[model samples]
Target: MASPLEEKTVARLVAAATAAPSMHNAQPWRFRFLTGERVVLLHADLERAMPRSDPDNRALHIGCGAALFNLRVASVHAGLAPRTRLVPEPEDPLLLAAVHLAGPAERAPDPDLARLYPAIRQRHTSRHPFADKDVPEDVRATLREAAAREGAELLFPGPWHADTVLELVRDAESRDVMDPAANEDLVRWTRLGPEADTAVDGVPEYAFGPRKRDGKAPVRDFTGRRPVADRGSTSFERTAHLALLSTPGDGPADWLRAGQALERVLLEATLADLATSLTSHALEDRDLRLLARDPGSGTGQVQMVLRLGYGPRGPATPRRPVADVLDVV
Candidate 1:
C-alpha cells in the first residue's frame, strides 16, 4: 500500500493546480483531498460559471480539466503517480475527476509529465503582439504531439482558413458589442484600475495588453468601452499565427479532454520559447465554432484557438488562495 500523503504536500499540489489558466482567469475549480482514499477530487465551482457566455458549462469543464492536468504534473514532479478518472461518477456531474495519488513504490513517475513541471510556473498568456515571424516546423510538431497525448487535435490553419477564423472572431466581437447581455460575463470578470492591483482573481488591466492598432489576431479586448490608464495601442502581427484545438465529440468529456490538451500544448509551447495567447471568442458560439473548424476536414469540434509567436509574455494573473478553493476530507 502507498504511504499516506502529508497535508502540506497536498496543499502544495493544489496550489500548483490552481495555477492553470481559465477563461478570464476565473479559476473555476475546487479540490477535495480524501485522506483515507489517497485521492484528490476535482469539482466545478459552478458559482464561477459564466452563464451569459458559457450557458452550457462547457468552458467551466475545460477550466477544471486544465486544473486536473496540472495536478497530474505536480504529482509526477513530487514523485507520485497520478492515476486519473474523468467523470468517475455520473450522478455527480460537478465532480470532474478523481486522481489517485499512488506513491513512487507503486508506480514510476512519468518523465514526460515531470519534464513539464518547470513550464507550469513559467507559462503565462502573452496577449501582446508577437513578432511577425514563423514558428518553425519542429516546434509546431512538438505542440501537436502534446495535444495528441491528451486525446485532442491541434492544427495550424492555412492562410485562407486562418482568415476565416479571424473573421468569425470579429463576428463574435461585433455580437458582444451589440448584445449587452453577452458582455455581462466580461464586465464581471475583468479587473480595472485599483481593482486590478488587489483582486485575487479575474483578468487584470495590466495583463490586457495593448489595443490592436493593426493586426489580424483575435485577441479579446477586456477593456470594453471602459477607460484604462496607461493603456496604449500598437500594431500586432499583420498575419497572425493561429492554431485550432479540436476534439472528435462536442460533449462534456470532450471539453475536459480539450482543456487538458490545451494546457499541455501551452506548456510545450512555453518550453519551446514561444509566447502564446488563447482566443475563445469564435468558439463561444456553436455556430461560429463549427465555422472555425477545418473546411477541408470538418470532422472535430473546435474547442480553442491559440495564437503563438515570439513576443513579450503576459504577466502572471492572480489566483484565489488555496484555502479558498480546496477542502480536506
Candidate 2:
C-alpha cells in the first residue's frame, strides 16, 4: 500500500501536470495513479485529439510532453525521484508513460528547472510583437542547451532561412484560412465570452492576440474566421529570433522525447523572462519538412519552430480541474 504522503504527492503532481500547455489548450491527457505499485500512468485522451491540425499526433505528443515535465518537477518539489519509462506498453497504445516513484534522491533539484517551476503557471505564448531588442547570444546558447538536455536540437536559422520559413508559414495561414473545413474545425474549438466558461478545451478569445488588419507576417490566427471584437493591435518585432526543435528520428517515441524537450526549452525561456510562440507550419508540409532537415548532418528531424524574444505576456489559458484529469484508482 502507498503511504498517505505518497498519495498526496501524486495528487500534487496531477495538479502540476494540468497546468501544462496544450495545442489550443486542449489538455488531451489522463492520469491514473497506481498507489500499490507507486506508479503513475499517463494516457492520451483520444477524444481530445485535434484531428484536423494534429492528425499525426505531433501536437498531442507535445502536449503530453508538457504534462510529463510538470510531473517531473512536481516529483522534485515533493521530495521524490521520478524514474520514467516512456511508451512502456506498446500493447496499450494510449499509455504514454509509466512514472515509478522512488524515494528522494540525494542530488539537489536542477536549479534551472526549479527556477522554471514557478513560471509554469506564469508562462504564456505571446503573439504580439516583441521589442526591437535582440535576444542576447548567451541567452540563446542557454536555451539551446536546455533543449539539448532533453534530446532535442534548437537551431537558430540565419536570416535567409528564417525568411524562407516565414514564407512557408504564410502559405499555411493562407491555406488554413481559405479551406472552409479547416476554418470550421478551428472555429469549433474556439470559445469566447460565456462560451469560454463552459469550454474545457480550445483557445479562449482573450488568448488570441489582435488580428492584423494590414500585411504582417503570419502568426496562427486562432481568430481568423470568427472575429473577436475589441482585440487590440500592437507592433510586432521586425526581427524575430527563430529556433527549430529537432530529433534524430520521426516516430512516436521520438515525438514524445521531442515534446518533453520542447517544454523544457520553453520553461527555461520563461524563467529567463522571454516570451515564446511556436509554429509548425513548415513542418506540417511534407516538402517543407524535408527541406527543414540539414542534408549533411542527416541526424535531425524538425519537430517544432519556436519564436523567442522579450514581449508582453499573453493571458493565461484555461485548464480542466485536477480532479477531472486524475484518477485515484
Predicted model with the maximum lDDT: 1
lDDT of 2 by residue, 75-140 (tens): 776766677899998999899999876665434554455566787787788777776677889988
- RMSD for all candidates, in order, please: 0.7, 2.2
lDDT of 1 by residue, 83-188 (tens): 9999999999999899999998888989899899899999999889888999999999999999999999999999999999999999999999899889999999
Give TM-scores for every candidate, taking all chains together and pairing residue i with residue i.
Answer: 0.99, 0.93
lDDT of each: 0.92, 0.78
**Total clashes for model 1:** 0
- Deviation in Å, model 1, residue 49 alpha carbon: 0.3
Candidate 2 accuracy as lDDT: 0.78
